[model samples]
Target: MDLQAQIEREGFPPGTSVIPLAEPGGQLFRATQDGGTRGLELLLTNEAVRMYGAGPSLALVLSRLRERAERGLPPALAPGVYERQVFVGD
Candidate 1:
């Protein structure tokens, strides 16, 4: 299934804005109503904690985004892309 279809299957709230990334592995970013943005990435096989990594499921990511929206937090980073380290933990 595609990202949007998966999200709908996962039952994310209606009108949730998800921007699909051009990269592989179903990566995407969700924008909260409060203007906060979070990048979501799938974990590799057996991987645990890591940078720019989302939770084990899309539901979790939606829940987190909901919380952020309620809190009205500003965007964590600027619009442009930048290089950053991504560490995968066991």
Candidate 2:
């Protein structure tokens, strides 16, 4: 998907880490900042994450990331000023 592609090409930002606040398989993505100091640990997957857009892999991850980015992820969501998500089932 474009999300992974962008991450692989550019990245989330200067300070962001895509982490799994609650994922079914426990797999996750982490986007960090310089010196590995401050950043956002956005929830990659929660419960039974799905998609209304693309593939099985990028759907939840990208959706949650966008959700967190727009709705303002919780402070503890990540390591610093991270974010959160609504579990796929919840």
Top candidate, metric lDDT: 2
TM-score of each: 0.39, 0.38
Candidate 2 — worst ten consecutive residues by lDDT sum? 81-90
Cα lDDT for residue 56, model 1? 51
Q: Compared with the true structure, what per-residue lDDT tens digits does model 2 show for residues 19-52?
A: 4343454345543344334334434343344433
Candidate 1 lDDT tens digits, 1-90: 565665555544444454545434333444433333532222232232243354554455555554544455344465533222222443
Task: State, as a TM-score between 0 and 1, how close model 2 is to the true structure.
Answer: 0.38
Which residue pairs in candidate 1 have backbone atoms (N, alpha carbon, C) closer than 3 angstroms, thus clashing? Answer: none
Least well predicted 10-residue stretch by lDDT in candidate 1: 40-49
Off by over 4 Å in 2: 1-6, 9-11, 14-25, 50-60, 63-87
Return the clash pairs for model 2, or none: 16-31, 17-31, 18-29, 18-31, 73-83, 74-83
lDDT of 2 at 44: 34
Position 22, candidate 1: lDDT: 43
